[model samples]
Every structure is written in structure tokens, then in C-alpha cells.
Target: MDWLGLLAFGDTGWGDELLYGLGITLGLSLATFPIAILLSFLIHWAKASKHRPVRIAAHAYTTVFKTLPEILTLLILYYQSQAVVNWLTGWIVPGSSLSVSPFLAGLIALSLVISAYGSEVVRAALNAIGKGQTEAAQSLGLSPFNTFRKVILPQLWRHAIPGFGNLWVILLKDTSLVSIIALSDLVHVATLAINTTREPFFFYLVIGAIYIVLVVLSTRLQKTLEQRASKGITRMEVSDA
Candidate 1:
């Protein structure tokens, strides 16, 4: 099909739904990224806690999540949510049905998965800081909290950005797994288009194109962030108290 035919909105084509799905995918990924990053930072702090119990708890969380299969985690959430929604509404909500809403289920699942990996990235980034830096800050009389906020966080972010960026792209792609939940996301839409039109190649190719564009643009943006993060070194000037 020609460019016009490829994009036309009708039984013949799916230009409009594709564009809308693209927006949903981008919005979902970006929205969840911040949540994942915040959760990751907290987990990182928990992992780095001075108290042995806190540290052990944090260690167990990351270890457990990292070992989980993604589908199993999501399925557990999906079924639990299904029960809750039906109980609250007094109507068996369709999430437990053969067709669930892919969007929210996928979001919850991918966020959990990304947060798992993101926490590790964050912990490593913070650990990469020379221990002497914090001690030097303490010697100069900055409080523990202030030291982390001013001296440690700035440097830690620079190191974590690259890893976070890569993970963001991966999570964005992982959004496709939501199809099992039945949301009409891009992949689900493509499946519909292919099944109905009997043109698997055409729809699949279109899906690939959309995903490639998103990943490439994201990769380029991350490269810019990587450059910015690398250029300035955070050095704390501490004088003996």
C-alpha cells in the first residue's frame, strides 16, 4: 500500500488508532518512570541504611523481586485486582474476564519490574561514591541528611542516569506484555489489524516502526543526558573543623 493507503482510517487502514496508541504508550511509560525512579531511590536508601535490619529488609526486597518472573507477578496482581474490583462494585468486573484492560494491568506490572532493576541501579550509583566523601562532609559538620541531599545525590544521579535511561526504554517495550490483559495498546491494535485484515506482515511491520521510533528517540535523548552527566564532576570542598 502507498503512504496514503497505509495511514487511511477505515477497514482498510489504522493510521488514527496507531497514533492514539502511540500517545498512550508514551504517556504510560513516562508516567511510570517517575514512580519507578522515586521508588528506586527509596529502596536504595533503605538498602544503604546503617541499621542491619533495615539493610536486610531492603536486600530481601530487591533479591526477591529480581528473581520473580514478570508474567507471574503481573498475573497475581491482575487476579487480585479482579477480585477487589468485583467485591467493591458487587459486579464481577471484567478484569478477571478473558479480556482485561491491558493498560492499567500492564502499568502496574511493568512498574514493579522496572523498580526492581532501577533500585539496583540506584544502589550501585550511590555506592560508587567514595566513602571518604561522606566522612569528609561529616567532618566539615554537615548533617547526615544534608550530606546526602547536597553532596551525594547530585553525584549519584549523574552515574544512575545512563542505566535508568536504558531501563526506561526497556520498560517502554515491555509495555507490550499488557496485551494479555486485553488493553488495545499498540501491539493489541496491531494484532486486531492483522487478524481482521489477514495482513500480519503489514501490521507487524507498522508495530516495529512505531517501537523503533520511540526507542531511537529515547536513546538519543539519553545520550545527551549522559554527556551532561559526565561533563561536570561533583567535588565537595571540605575544610577540617
Candidate 2:
């Protein structure tokens, strides 16, 4: 079969399998993103709290996750979480068996690492907001929640866009790690195809191309979001006149 024919969607080729694996890669990354964002915000809030213990606990959360290797964390969560869950289920309902789906385990593990890094970005964004902005909102009779939503979040997002863009690109590539647990993501299927066809060069090159395409598209989307967030904000450009 010719090189092109090998990528054909007909029964003679592996296109369908590759497409399905790509779908899983995209789905997993998208599903994990919002969870990571929420987790980061919660961690940042804890760190920002007036309570001393809350701040300490939040720091510890980021410290431990950020210090550990991501793959090791995933491996532990993938295997150990099931045992932990089954133990609880056994006590709650006799003979009940509980299992953590590989997808869920991967998502949780990725989110932990992502959120640990993301929390710093969020905290930095929060700190970038001027204290006078909050005071102004209060003087205008806006409640604390209203001040956060209206006066703070918009500016926070503007500062956060660049950091988040980097995180997202990293997250997309990181989804390939799920293949280690046999999730059949893009890299996994490409490896399977190579094994069957004995065309490792062609298949692996295809995998690299797919990743490049994803990152290129993501970068474009990130630029658009950055522009939208920066709308009406003025910057002083210094040039040799």
C-alpha cells in the first residue's frame, strides 16, 4: 500500500482507529481543563484567606504536588485510589466493589499538577489588581462578591491569559501521558499501528504532525483570547523616533 493509502479511512487502513484516539486525546484535555481552573481558584482562595492554617495548608498542597514527578503521581493515583475507594465501599456497603476509571484517574492526576502550577498564576493575577480597585468598588456600594465579579475578574483574566496559554499548550501535550495507563490516546494508537504495520517511522511522524497541528491551532486561539481580554487596555510602545 502507498503512504497515502495507509491513512485512508477504508477497512484496509488504520485511519478510523487513529481518529478515535485523537478524539480521546482532545476530550481528555478539554474535560480536565475546567476542573484544573476550579481547583486553582480554590487553592488561591485558601492561600489568600486571613486564617493562618488555611494559608499553610494551601501552600503545602502546591508544594507537595509541584515537587513530585507528574508520572509518579499518576501511577500512584491510578493504582492506589481504587484500593482506597474499595476500602470505603466495603465499610459502607458489604461486598460492594468500587473501581476508578482510568480516564478519571488520569484527569485527577493531571489536574493536580496543572492546578499546582495554575494556582501561582491565579495568585499573581489577583495580586496584580490594585487595592484601590476594591476600595473604589466598596465606595460605590458594591458588595464583596460584586467587587470580585465585576471589578476584579476581568482584570485578573487579562493578566492571566499568557500564563494560561502556556498551561493549556502544556496540558494538551501532557494528555499523551495518559497512554501509559493504556488509554489508547493518540500516541498509544500510533504505537499500535506501527507495531502492526512495522512502519514505525511513518506512524511516529504522523503522530508528531498531529501534535504540531494541535499546538499551532491552540496558539492561534490563545492569541485571539489575549486580544479579547486586552480590549480597551492601552500600552505604551517605545520606538526610536
What digit string (tens of lDDT, one per residue) describes model 2 on residues 71-177? 88999999999999999999999999898988899999999999999999998888888789999999999999999999999899999988888998899999888
The top-ranked prediction according to TM-score is 2
TM-score of 1: 0.84
Candidate 2's TM-score reads 0.93
> Per-candidate RMSD vs. true structure?
4.8, 2.9
**TM-scores across all candidates?**
0.84, 0.93
Q: After TM-score superposition, what is the CA distance of residue 23 in candidate 2 from its true location, in Å? A: 0.7
Per-residue lDDT tens digits for candidate 1, residues 35-129, read 88888888877887899999998788778768888777778878887766666655555434343355677777777788889998987887788
Worst 10 residues of 2 by lDDT: 232-241
The best candidate in terms of lDDT: 2
The 0-to-1 C-alpha lDDT of every candidate, in the order given, reads: 0.79, 0.91
Model 1 lDDT, full chain set:
0.79
